[model samples]
Target chain A: METQLFVQIALNGWNQQVARAEKFFNGLSDEAFQRTVGAGKNRIIYLYGHLTAYHDMLKETLGLGTATHSFLVNDFLKNADDVKANMPSVAELRQYWAEVHNELNVLFAALPAEDWFKRHNAMTDEDFKKDPTRNRLSVLLSRTNHIAYHFGQLVLA
Target chain B: METQLFVQIALNGWNQQVARAEKFFNGLSDEAFQRTVGAGKNRIIYLYGHLTAYHDMLKETLGLGTATHSFLVNDFLKNADDVKANMPSVAELRQYWAEVHNELNVLFAALPAEDWFKRHNAMTDEDFKKDPTRNRLSVLLSRTNHIAYHFGQLVLA
Candidate 1:
């Protein structure tokens, strides 16, 4: 498919699923969010924080600045207790998520169709070669897809 | 993620999306299903045939018995009219897809878990290894994911 087609399809999928997660967590109590689930693999809190962190990294990597921080990496660097203690309040988390979601939507909506095929370096220094038919748009869609995939995991957990 | 978790998560995502696609296509009209969404890409009819063929190949590659014919490969060899002029009716396509899906699920369920990690020779005589915890499952999931990824294209078209 062409660059435009890929980005539109990806955005449609990402918007639907991420909105679902946002609403589900919006009504949850802080204590409930922190309660371990799935044999401690992920709690609701960790899932939210991880999603925020991951998207933020992708945004920054793609040259779109993000306000969210990477708690998963931070937890690894510091301690689990510190990560837990730094958890955003439910309202704060909700606002941050909405901001990120809307910010991303704005970014996607405003993207120049031509830039969709422009080559750029990924965070890993992987050189993404450019081809007009399906290039940078595919890469951006790939990042959004990362969000959609993890959103499914959050839903199941 | 560890190899085991990575493989399992990948498998879970693959199966979940396939189930969604199967359910969606089950409700589509025969004409709609056979509509030439494109060439060298999935239409609903071509996808069913392609996925079944790949699963059969996977079984054979794993030294499991043949469960289905590789229709697309043979058709290409014979220069048959592509799905363009020769698409199956929706019912036939659905039946073929269901049969292949069932066979794949059963075959996977029956495999010894250890086989996922066993090393084997590639058809090209290259050294190949299967890590249930990593390699085999990743490849298996990719088989479906590659389909799902393209299927999204079919739907969008």
Candidate 2:
């Protein structure tokens, strides 16, 4: 397949997962978001926030822009869900989720086909040179799966 | 990136998920497999068998080989888990999981890079002509996410 087509396929997969997540979280009730995946697992709210924070970081990770929601890093990314930790309300998280993905969609579309194969900010130049498979497209693919993984947990709520 | 590199990345993602599922399931106690993801959702055994059955179908879906575990289709694929339905023992499902993925790993590695871009058995020639993105590699990518989705549920067990 052509390189452009390959890039499109990867992007399409990412977009599909993004859409699924958006729809699922949008429909969830505020109370439902408080429920854990199991008796003692991450709550739906935390997963939603964690996903949003991760997507926000993708801006810098992909070298397209800066992370707009860095404030969510400590609560949603670095630490697991804590009842005591200050968290955004479900309404605020919903807004942040939409904002992060909306901005990402634009940045992702503007990325040239060849640029998807280039190294992202997370990889060292020498490391990327030695292992070119760890490119922007691969990161997108991994993140796509990441969303699906968490969405699985969300479904149990 | 080169086409070979693209194929490698997709396959690597698939393999990584497979390894994770293997490790997670193997370490789980037989009793744990009986637990559901939530209070009334799919039990871990059902998800294990469901994933195994899906991978078995991939053999034919990729046009590489025939399914070796067609017996699992009706219970694990065509229908949801039923308390009254006859099911495989946890040990049996574990064995099937290993067999299906082990065989697939061999078939997948033997496939040429260019072949990954070709249409799979599930797609029509006309549809594939209009949309080449629905190729074998795309199926693998989707299935990779599928496993990750289920793995998320499995983790809650």
Candidate 3:
């Protein structure tokens, strides 16, 4: 595969994952959003916020855009997937999600193909050289899988 | 993007999803496999079987291979997602999962790039002509997302 085409497919696949989420969530009732699934006992509202929080963090992490949910990192990232009382409501989280999704898509659309191969997140030159797979495009691709994981769970919810 | 490279990357991505599922399912304990999520409601075994059955059908639908579980098609396919009393044991389902997964991977690996562009499953030539998006490669790509969706749910299990 030419590097350009390879990157484009990855980018389109990533966007498709996002679109799947929007399609899955579109027109879902508010009661449905608050529904809980699994023995873990988390509500869909919490998962939606958690998903949006990750995207918000990813925007900053990949330098595609700025972080929109600096407040959510502690509650959502590395935290157990349990329901938290303080999570933003489904409506607010959806707005945050749409914002991050729009900006990230724009960033991806505007990105030069070469930029996909650039260093990402907090990695220094030496860090990136040692693990070239940690590049910006890799971040996009991995986050795509991450989003898919949550969407699967949502369907069950 | 050259069509060949685009198809190649798509193929590799499809296999990567399989590898991820194998890695996730490899060492799961029998108890864990049967463990119920959604508050003792849905069992992992049912979900596993459902996932495998989908692949078995996809192999035939994409013309990659024959169906390994015609018997399972009636129960697991369009039926409800709930756990069933008559469902196969975890080991038996695992065997089916492995068989379908292996054969499907082999089929995908050997698929000609041009075939990926051909019409798929129930789509007639006339339908494919109207909406080329319903081609074989599109099926593989969509199923890749399907696998990811289930994997997300499995991790919770």
TM-score of each: 0.46, 0.96, 0.74
Q: What is the DockQ for all candidates, taken in turn? A: 0.03, 0.84, 0.33
Candidate 3 C-alpha lDDT tens digits along A1-157:
2455446657767778888888877768877876765554567776677777888888778877788677776666767555444666667777888887887778878888777777886799999777665677666666777778788777777
Give the better candidate number (2 or 3) by TM-score. Answer: 2
Evaluate model 1: give its TM-score: 0.46
Tens digits of per-residue lDDT for model 1, B45-109 = 66556655666677666565574756645532234336545555557657777887788788776
Candidate 2 residue A102 Cα shift, in angstroms, is 1.4
- lDDT, residue B105, candidate 2: 88
The share of true interface contacts that also appear in candidate 2 amounts to 0.85
Q: Where is model 3 chain A poorest over a 10-residue stretch in terms of lDDT? A: A1-10
Give the candidate order by descending lDDT.
Answer: 2, 3, 1
Candidate 2: segments with Cα more than 4 A from true spot: none
DockQ of 2: 0.84
Angstrom error at residue A15, model 3:
5.0
Ranking 1 against 2 by lDDT, winner? 2
For model 3, residues B132-153, the per-residue Cα lDDT tens digits are: 6667766776777777777777
> What overall lDDT, based on C-alpha atoms, would model 3 receive against the true structure?
0.73
